[model samples]
Structure formats: structure tokens, C-alpha cells
Target: MSNFVFVLDTNKQPLDPIHPGQARRLLSSKKAAVYRRYPFTIILKHLSLEPNSTPSQIKIDPGAKVTGLALLQGDKVIWGAELTHRGFAIRDALLTRGSFRRGRRSRKTRYRQARFLNRTRPQGWLPPSLLSRVENILTWVKRLIKFCPVSSIVSELVRFNTQLMQDPTRQKEGYQQGTLYQYEVREYVLEKWGRKCAYCGVKNVPLEVEHIHPRSRGGSNRPSNLTLACVPCNQAKGNQDIRDFLSSKPDLLKRILSQAKRPLADAAAVNSTRYALLNALKKLGLPVTTGTGGQTKYNRAVQGVSKTHWHDAALVGETPQLQFLTNNPLLITAKGHGVRQRVITDKYGLPKQHRGRFKLSHGFKTGDIVKASIPKGKYAGHYDGLRIAIRTKPSFALYPKNGGKQFDTHCKYLNTIHKADGFAFSFVGGDSSSA
Candidate 1:
């Protein structure tokens, strides 16, 4: 057009009315310009303060929130920090040091300051609450009606609870906080459940936690977040809400939500997820002949089904293996692991703990080495090891620690030269080997 110079599209979303995407510059420097002022700024949380910064740093604090500004920059981060005030030499150094020391607690201070100092702006095209409702409606409608109503090719619908992400800590694990809807659902269940198992009245057994809101429909994992479920009840309940879990019953979702308790409503939510499995031996679905109740080897049957059922597993005859960053960070999820654990062995222990799923956050080349530490136990000291590829199914691959596989249960889990600290390992070289 005219003589306007162009460089790159800097995301200029405002931090407040004074500034949008220019938070770093506006907050740090006065000369920086902001187009808007007095805006309703969202307080973003860092999903993970300690993210996959570098291939060397795998398995960060896991507790650190990743919903901060300086996020998704990958691991090569200096830190999500800024230098506020400085006198000259002495004052500057002190300010820098203080920034590093505040830790997670400082995030609260940032929130207080932002809320008090920043001006709230009026909604333009969309209000956050309305937008969130739209998202919920779309999600439910898609499930009930199928397909999102009115869509753009570039529009990407993220998970629910996007607003909670402003806080950096919860950001890392995907803004996974319990919501008001979830709380309402839980309260409804407890009210209906008379404080004990409906069928057995046994209160001591570790209760199974479930959601009236199906996990597939953006449900989250939390306490007011869940309902009491016994193994026997759960097996019968499956994935469907309570009514669907039982036949000839009406859908309870609405009554459950409105009745304010999970159990009492005639059509309220209950469990009805189907656990379907067929033995290769019987067309009528003959149960296995191996385990206590004639079930196939636990791991073999559920190897790829920790997240889902065997019929829904990725592979037909084989198990799906955990993907790694080449030989870097191991993919891990915080739920239902037994379904996957049975794959390593055929033993079927009682389903006791919460499910743990495998998750691979990032990938690395063969040459990229990751620095990891022993999570717990005797191997408290850190060491180093080479990475060797552990090939499972041709389609699935994972790289176990090279040199010696110490993390293995078969005694190799220990190191020869034990240091007071835990062990370290790398992808390629760069101090990736134990001397």
C-alpha cells in the first residue's frame, strides 16, 4: 500500500487497558505503547513453570504451573521472570536475586497487584462467561446432536476451564481444576448416596470416583469432582450415566443436574460405560481360562487399554507402547495405569489405585540426551546413562536407559556407584554416561 513498514505479527492482545500483548514491554518499560487501557485482563497461570525446557530436563517438578506469559517457548527458557526496579549496580543485583527467590508464592502477589492496579474493560464482541457457556453448549450439543454449530476453519475449540489457565501452575497439567458444574454434580451424588455403598453398605472399601459429566465431554479429575463407586457397582455401571448403565431407565443427566444430587433423580447421571471384550476362542464370548475367573493375562488383555477398552485399543493383536522423546522423557498421564500395566506382566492384582496413563510430552532425536533424576527410594543420588531404543511392536517404540537398565525391578534398578543424589541420563552424549 503506502509506506508502512512490516516486520512480524506480534500478538498485541492487551494485558490491561494500558497494554495488551505488550505486557513485557509495558510493565518493564514506560516508553512501550499500548493501544487499549482499562481492560478486563485475564490472569493467566503458567501450565508448567518447569516445562520441557530442554531435552536434558525431563520430568520437571510436575507441580509447577505452565499458565504464565513466557510459556510454550519450549525448554530453552531462562525463566518466566522480569526485572522490576533497580537503583544502579547494588539495587539491580538485589532485584534480580529477589525475582528468582519468590517461587510459586509470588504468583499470588502478581494476581493481587493485577486485580487492584489494572482497570477492568467492557466486553466487546464476546464475554468470557458467555464464551464459556457457548463452549459447554457446543460440547454437549455435539455429543447429543453431533457437529459444532457454526464453525470456522481456523477456529480450534480448546478444553473447558480455559480461564483457570491464567494461573501458571495449573496450566502445565492442562488447566485441570474442578469446576462449579462438577461440584454441583458431586453434591447431588453424595446426597443420594446415604454415606455408604447403596448395594453393600460397606464404607471401608476405597470408593471408586466417577463423573456425571462424562470425561469425554471435557470432564475433569477432582474430589467434589467425583462420586462414590464400588468396583462391583462400577463394573455394572460402565461408562453410561446411572440410568443408561441400567436398562429400560430414562436418561438422568438433566434431573441429576437439576435435582442437585447424583443418585436420587429418576433420570440423573449414573455409570454405563461398556467394558466389552471377546475371547478369540468363543463366538459367544467365552471367558479366558487363565486368571482366577478365567480371564486372559491381565497385561496382555489390557495392554493398550488403560485409557480405553481392548476393543477400542489402537492395535488389533498387539499392544500400544509408550512413546518417548526418542530416548528422552517418557510419556506419562496421571490416571488408570493397570490397564496398561497388565501388558508388562500377566498378573492381575485387584484394581486398587487411581488409573495412571502414559503420556509423551515432547520428542527428541537420537542425539538429544535428557537429564532425569530418580523419583524416589534408595537410588536417591543422581547418575548418568546412555539411551538405547527398546523396540516393542514395530509401530511402537521406547528407549530405555542404556549402559545398565537400573530402573528395572530386577535389581538393575540400583546403580553400581551410588551418589547421595539421584541419577541422570541423556539422549546422546553430553554427560549422558555414568563413569
Candidate 2:
């Protein structure tokens, strides 16, 4: 099933989201018109005397790479989206800019005095990369609120205890230190073992936390005793000692033993901005609730729900028996608004080409979603995707959403579908309900 479409009244007041079929019928009868294309919102032509909008709650599962969003009306998930943040992109951009500045200074050019320890950061300061993740999540929260009647926010305020994983007895508080004990151990093992099967050296497969020294054979629950192995490998080496398991391959056995003993310093690449995210959500003045990773995992496990980011989100906190109404979720990738640099620079910081002051050409801008129809040519066809502007030129690049070859097309043949908002959109389908 696809996500439900958001609806709005004549005054632009948020209303209950309707199924896509209902939305199509409303548009066919000329009762509603398209309001926004990105979130697929429809606006009624006439004002409603009584708005029958059901209050929805936004549940977020924030991660380092992607943040899952689910709009839950009661126990049913109506709309779902997975937002991919570009934090690493921002970090790389900053690094490149700094390198360019430093290179220019070292080229025997006239340089300004070095400034150090002069700028003081405000309280709760975060690196730009980390801050971008929070900002990306917050931006979607505001957008969803505007398009849907969000009554409350639920966020997974989870962190990892690297110290606990390394030394479980160091803190006697017993696993409830942000994440579940088993999950912490599994996470640490995955990092230390490079997320590959320790037995077969296989990668990208689901791994099980296998004891190197068999637990049945008196292996203690230490981080050094845990390793990861693929399902097939684990089953094949069931309860076998590490040395016995890899007796034929003595070299591989030695390597695994040595690596498992070496402690990993940063096993928990936890999202440091989880509390910052919580604080920001609290400032929204809505009833905000938080859940732990352990709680989320328990909720998901008891329901036997298949693990997807959006599925995890729906089971965030105080969840009832959930009903999955949609299997396909909107995929949103945060592509920041174009940079402000006018003079394009080369590796040596030399000016290569100057960019135009205006980004629009014939009422169309870069990143705007457009539908194009070309009568006849090598690239002749109908296309619907974001337009890549060819500065001051009449032709723009058309990137089809259906994995078609990209080609340049004339602006006259294009129709605007959705204005760009610093995000790329798509969709993916998978079963998120119980297996």
C-alpha cells in the first residue's frame, strides 16, 4: 500500500490524511485541487463548516545516516517517510573550504594574522555535521506538522554505552544505560569485527553474535569472547570453540583471536545530538514523549514486525497494537540549497568560472520538479523529475525518476510539478508489518 495523501481545508487548515484512492476521487470531482506535490497535499475549494480531522502523532527514529518519520493516527500508521541526511556532505564541503584557504595562505601570498582561540562557542554547540542531522529532522517535523494535524511528537532518544560494552561490570547499573545490553554488545562486536563474518570473512549479510570461546564450554560473557558470524557459518560452527572451528585455517584463527582481544575505542558511534533533538522537540510546545532503543526493540520484537527504519519509528513509545496501512514510504534525501559561492574555484583556489546572480530561467529554477514531453529525438519521451539548470541557457537536464537516461530538454516542453525545497524525493516498497 502507498502512503495516504495529506488534505487541507480552504483556509489551509490541516485535516486528516485520506487514502490515495479517495484523494483521486476528490480531484476527479473538482472538489479539491493539488496544493503541494512533495508531500502530496490537496486543498479543498470551499471552506468546510466542520473540519473532521483526526489528531496524528509524529514518531521519529533518528539515526546517524537516516531518520524515519511516521504519522500515526491512533494505532494506524497513515503516512511514512525516511529522510536521509547529508551530514557527511556538509563536513566534506567545510574541509574543502578550509583546505583551500590554507593552501592560499601557504603560497607566499599576503596573509592576514592568524586568529586562534578568539571565537567562543555558545552553549550546546555541535559540529556542523552533527547539527545538520538535527536541523534536517526538525525541518521535516515542521513540514509534517504544516501538512498534517500533528498532536504530539514521539522521538527515540537513544544513546550507546561504549564503556559498558567494553567492560560490563564497570557500571553496576545493569544494561539499562541508554540501550539494551545485548544490542550494545552486538554493536560493539560488529564494529570491532568490521561488520563482516568473522568465520567466513563474508560481508553485507545478517550477522549473529557468536561466542568465540563457546559459552557451553565455559566462555565468559566478555567483549573479547564475542564475534560475529553469518547465519550459515554460525549454524555450521554451532557451539564449537574458536580454535577448533578454524583449526584447519590456523592463520585466520590467530587473527580473529588477536583482533577480539584488542579493544575498540569508538565502537559506539552514537548520535551525540539525541538530547539536542529532544530539547528542540520540547521547544515546539507540543506534548513530546521519548523512548529508549531498548524499548523500541522490545516493542518491535514482541510485534514480530519486520525491521525497517519507518517500522521502528511507528513503534517508538507508548505504542498500541499497530496497523500498517502503507507499505511504501516516501524517500527524502536532504540536498541542501545551492551554495552562495559566486566565483567557482579550482584546486589551487584560482577562479575558474563565475556563476550567475539569478538561478531562475523562464520561471524555472534548478532542482525544480518538472514534467517534460519531447515530440521526437534520441531522448524523445515523457519525463518527470528534477530539472538541473544549465545557467543562462534555455535547455535543462531532465532526470527521470524511473531510472531513465538523463537528457537535456527545452524549457518550453517542461511543466512545473513541484518547486524545489532542497530535497530530492522518491519511493521504495517493502513489507513493514509482521512477517
Candidate 3:
């Protein structure tokens, strides 16, 4: 067979803490933008499991471990490996440069035109025009900071738009980044609890996701069957009398009873691309800021007028109306950081957990930890009235933050000891019984 090798940069540490397939995952992450700290020379190996030695012997692909060789070449190979499989994508894989042009039919142009067209009449969007004209008109006259000049602004604006307009091609790669996303999910699982059985809370960073219901026995990636477990845990829970993975961990089962049990707060930011937008904005030399999103403005006149007139209505010149960077750019959450609050309640409104017994949608097992909230009663201070519970969810869902810390309205129910007023009970099955 044949092999492919790579010489990676010496800077980046092991990103995911796992061994094999590290390079594929790393390069797949943060696409197009290279991680300067970590670089690598990939080695691809073309091999056949059955050595029939003929033209029709066989051909291999990415998922086939036997067909690929993922090596950690700090300097030399600890174990012998010559070839690597075709694991596409790298941190620095540049998008083929093209003339970025603005056409009447393009999405950016459509939004800009729509914004300008929408201005013909107000959609009751402007809260109080009378108040706006009164306050903003006066504000604009008093504070006139000296930028280079409008001529300079106009010139720069022209240059930027000209550059943006250079790209004319309209072909969608549709960007099938699933392979990369798959790698990320694997890394997240391994890094969270090592290689131990997730149900039993055993650490085995090297463990793989064992199907509690193996495909051979009729299982899909529906989540319940898929669990993090060592090779041995997987083997032990084989087909014969395979019970649910949750039965293994007492802590995970208990989270349901110990939790505040309320709705979630606003959305959190987690995707790596928003960070890309943040960085790109800074590199463009704008007084870049992190934020969720806000009402979009277009007119060269109104947009300019709004920022100059109002503080909250920020001014983004003729640069990239970067709304395209995000999937849901229209729903602007906040200006600085796109943090969303779910449902915040005053302490007076919070519900008290029943002291004696409580039940959860899920049950409590072992290896559970109880987290409590600081009660508002006499023991509120110094965690005196603190009550703990186990987590019930298999895995919690959290959004990524654009900047600072993003707190949710519903977050009072999670990652905290508190819960909403209507919510009763105090138990979480995850790591709580053990906690």
C-alpha cells in the first residue's frame, strides 16, 4: 500500500486530548481560518484489509480505520505508519479566491434594496419618531467627533464596496461540513469524561460511543443507544441483555429530582463561526464589537443618519453588511454580545423545593452529584439553605456566547441551584447522587 504524511507546526498542543484522528478533527474545526498555533503535515495511507494483491483487490475510504494511518509526528512515529486516508478539510484550507461582485439578484443587494425600499413608509418600527427627532437631532449637533473627513469616509467606502463587488461567481458549495461536525461531537464527548463509561462515570477518554442498541440489533444515532464507553464497557453491554446506558450511572439519573426544573433562559452562542465574524470585523479595522444581532439598516442616507443621531443604532459603514455571516442574523438579540435571557424571576417569585421526596422524569443512579441554589430564607447566606439535586438530562443544551457570559432567562433552572416559582421538586440525576 501507500502512505501520506504531514509535518505540523510545533506550537499547538493536543487540542482534543485524544490520540488517533486528532489531525482530522483539528483541521476540520474552524474551517478556512487556520490555527496558526497548531499546524500539521497529514499522512494518508492506502491499504487493504485483505491482501489479495490484485487490481480488483480493494479501495478504501475515510471511515475505514484499516485504510488510514493517523500519526502524531512530533518528530518521529512511535508506532510505524506510512499512509493516511482522505480526511478532507484543514484549518487553513483557503476558499478559492474569486471576484466578489454585487449583482441586482444577489442576497446582499436584495436586503439592501429591501431596506431602502422598506423606508418608503415606516412599519411602526421606529418606537417614537417625535421623541427620536427631538432627542437625536439635539444629540447630533452637540457631539461631532473629528473622523478624517467625509471625503475620506466616502473614499474608503468606495474602496470597500469596490472590493466586495469584485466577486461575481454564484455557485453554492452547499458546504457539507457534516464530516467536520462529526469529528467535533466525538472530541466533545471524549474530552468531557475521558474514556470511562458515561453511564457508569468511568473515565476512558479513549473510549468510543458504544451503541446500547447496536445497529445490528436495530439502533440508530437517536442518542439513547449512543453513549460514551470504553472498549470493555461496550463489550460487556453487548447484544444479549443490553439494558439502557442510563442505568449505569446513579448520578445521571438523580439530576432530574435535584434540578430547579424550569424553562430555559435566552439562547447562548456556541458555534465557532460567530467568533469568526467577530475576528473578521476586527481585522477590517472597525471599532468592532461582539453582539447577537439587531434591526438591519440599509440606505446610505438613513443608516448614516441613524448612527450619527442615535447611540443604540450603531453605524456600520459601507463595509460588509456582515449579516450574511450568521444563519439567523435578522433576530438581533443584543448589540455587544448576542446573549438572550430566557425567564428571569425575582427571588420572591422563586418556588421552594419540597424537602422530603421528589421525582424526576429520569431516575437517579450512581456517580451523581447534587447542585443546589442559595435559598432566600435565613440560610440564604453562605449557602446555609442550599439544596442540591442530580441532573436528569442525558446531555444539556447550551448556546454559545458572543462575548462576555451569556445568561439565559431559563438558566435559573440550570447550572444554578435556583428554579422558577412554578417548578417544584429538587433533584437532578447527573453526578448529583455522587456529588
Candidate 4:
């Protein structure tokens, strides 16, 4: 089913979200007008007699890369959205800018006086990349509150409990003793290797903890040095180095080594921001509820719902028998409203093109979603996409949503659908749960 439509009163107060069919009828009967295209909102022509709406709760499943949001009314999920953050993109941009500045410093500012290290960060400082994830989630939560009668918040606070695992900071003597240690290591390895034999990539078999570097050869009992292997594979590679065991399969050997060295960056990012997100939600004055990843998984499995970010969100905390009102979720990617740099430069810091002070041209700004109708040309047809760039001339560059080649379309043929909001929106998975 399609997502429910957000509705607003004539006074601009948020009303209860209604089904898409009801919204379509209201629009067709001239009782309501389109208020927002991205969220599919409508405004009533008359003020709502009952401005106070039935209290709905906002459920969130915050992740490292994407955060899922769902609007729950009673036991039914009315609207859903998956927000994709630009953490890596932000980091890359900052790195590029730093490189440019460093190059200039080395080339011409060698004699410049060094600056004092006087900068002090406040308590609870986060890197810009990680901070952006929290901000993106908060932005959407506030926006959803403005469009729905959100009275409470529910969030998945912990993806996995690090306390249950081995603490790298602890001394070897401080490690948990006996079965607890074995349990922690086994659980961690199962998750890391997908509960399969890491050597043969075989699943649904009895697997044993195998060492990458054999214990007899001075290998440490660190989690990174451990992997899963079936009985035969374990026996075959017993007391042998992983390199020697997988000598014939160089590619698999390399992959295993690389994966073993891979740090839990994604998990760390989520853990770092969980408390910040919780604090932000509490500041909203709503009764915030929290759940763990295990609880969410159980809730979803009990209901037989397909695994997806939004689905997990809808089943986050103390969930009842859920009735899904929508299978399609609005996909939102955080494409920050262009950059502040006026001049576009190349790798060597040479200016290539300068941006106009004013982005508007022919009554349209860059990033505005538009529908273009071409009467006749190489690209002669109706197209729907974003206006990536605007020209002083009549023609503008249009990037099609359906992966078509970006072509310039005249101002007369373009109709604005949605204004630039630093986000690109689309819908996916109407008949299924994978959105």
C-alpha cells in the first residue's frame, strides 16, 4: 500500500494523517490543496473543527548511514521514511578543503608565522561526519512533528552492547572468566562471520572457533585473530597459519585478512551518537522510549515482517500487534543545499568556474524538482527530475530521476514540483517491505 498523506488545517495546524485515497478525494472535491510534495501533505480550505489530533508516536531506527522513521497511530504504521545521510561525503569535502589549504601553505606561506593552538572544544564534541548523522535525524524528527501530532518518541538506542564483549582497554587479568569469555567470543565471531565457516563460506553447519594465526605460533586470543570454521576445515588447518592453509586461494586469503583487520567503525559511529539522539529527543518534551536491537529483531520476527530499516523502526519499542498501513516509504537522501564555495576549483587548486552570486534564473533556482516538457528535440518528451544547475540564459540543466542523460531544457517547458530543501525524495517498495 502507498503511504498515508499528511494533512494540515487552514490555520496551518497539523491534523491527523489520512489515507492516500481520502487525500485524493479531498483534493478532487476542492476541499484541500497540496501543501508539500515531498511528504505528500494537503491543507484544508476550511479550519479543522477539532484542531487537536489523536496523539501519534514517532519511532526511529537510527543507523550509521541511514536512519529510519515511522509515524505510529495506535497500532498502525501510517507513514514511513528512510533518511540517507552524507557522513562520508562531508568528511571527503573537508579533507579536500584541507588539502587545498595545505598545498597553498607549502607553496607560498612557508614564511608565515605559526598560529597558536588556542582552540578548545566544548564537552561532548563529535567529529563533523558523525555529528551530521545526529543532525539529519533531528531535522527529520522536528519536521515530522510539525506535520503529525507526534506526542512521544521511540528509538533503538543500542545496536549491540559493547560491555558484553571483550574490552580492549582492560588488562588480560580483568577479562571475564570461563564460559562468559567463551560465550562473548563465540557470539562475536558468529556475527562477524555470518554464522558460517569463514574458510569455505559454508552455512547451516556446526562451526568451531578457528584461529587465523595459530595459537602454537604465538597468536594472541584477540577477537580479530579468531574466525569460524567447520569441523573438517578446522582439523585440516589445525596448528597451521591461515596464510599456509589458504595458500592455493590467494584471493580468499586476502579477503579474510582484510576483513579481520576491518575495525567496527560503523558500530562505533552508531554507539557514539545514540545518547546524543536520545538527549535531543528528550529535549523535545516528549516521553521518549528506548529499545535494543535484540528487542527490535524479536518484535519484527514475531510479526513476520520483512527486514528493512523502516520496518525495524515501526517495531522499535514495546510494540503491540502492528498493522502496516503503508508498504512504501519516502526515500530521502541528505544532499546538503549546495556548497558555500563560490568558485569551483580543480585538484591543483586552480579556479575552473565561478558560481553566480544569485542562484535563481528565469524564476527557478538550482536543486528545484521540476517536470520538463520538450516539444521536439534529441530529448523530446516529458521528464521529471531535479534542476541541478540554472543558467542566465533560458535553458537549464535537468538531471532526470530515471537515470536518463542530463539535458538542458528551456524555462518555458519546466514546471516546478518541489522547491529545494537540501533533500532529494522518492518512493520505493509499494508492494513489498524492502524500502
Cα lDDT tens digits for candidate 4, 1-36: 888999999888999999899999999999999998
lDDT agreement of model 3 with the native: 0.26
Candidate 4: where are CA atoms >4 Å away? 109-114, 162-241, 376-380, 385-388, 429-435
How do the residues 1-435 of candidate 2 rate in per-residue lDDT, one tens digit apiece?
A: 889999999999998899999999999999999998878899999998988878899999988778889999999998899988888788888999888888878886776645797899999999888898889899989989998888999998763454454456765445434346766566557767888998889998888988888889998777788889999999999988777878899999889888988877332223578889999999988999988666777788899998788998999988899999998998888888888999999888878999889878898888888877889888777765555555578988776555556678788998888887888888774211100
Q: What ranking of all candidate models by lDDT puts the best one first?
A: 4, 2, 1, 3
Stretches > 4 Å off in candidate 3 = 1-182, 191-196, 222-225, 240-268, 272-283, 286-435
Write down the RMSD of candidate 1 (Cα, Å).
26.0
> What is the per-residue lDDT of model 3 for residues 124-243, given as tens digits with 9 covering 90 to 100?
232221222222212211111110000111101110012112334422221212323344334333333343565456552457766555788766553223457667766776764343
Give, for candidate 4, the lowest lDDT window spanning 10 residues: 426-435
Q: If scored against the real structure, what TM-score would every candidate get? A: 0.17, 0.84, 0.23, 0.83
lDDT of 1 by residue, 129-221 (tens): 122222222222222111111111101111122325345565533444333333333434544554455434568676655664557666556
Per-candidate Cα lDDT values, in order, are 0.28, 0.81, 0.26, 0.83
Model 2 weakest 10-residue run by lDDT: 426-435
RMSD of each: 26.0, 5.1, 27.3, 4.6
Ranked candidates, highest TM-score first: 2, 4, 3, 1
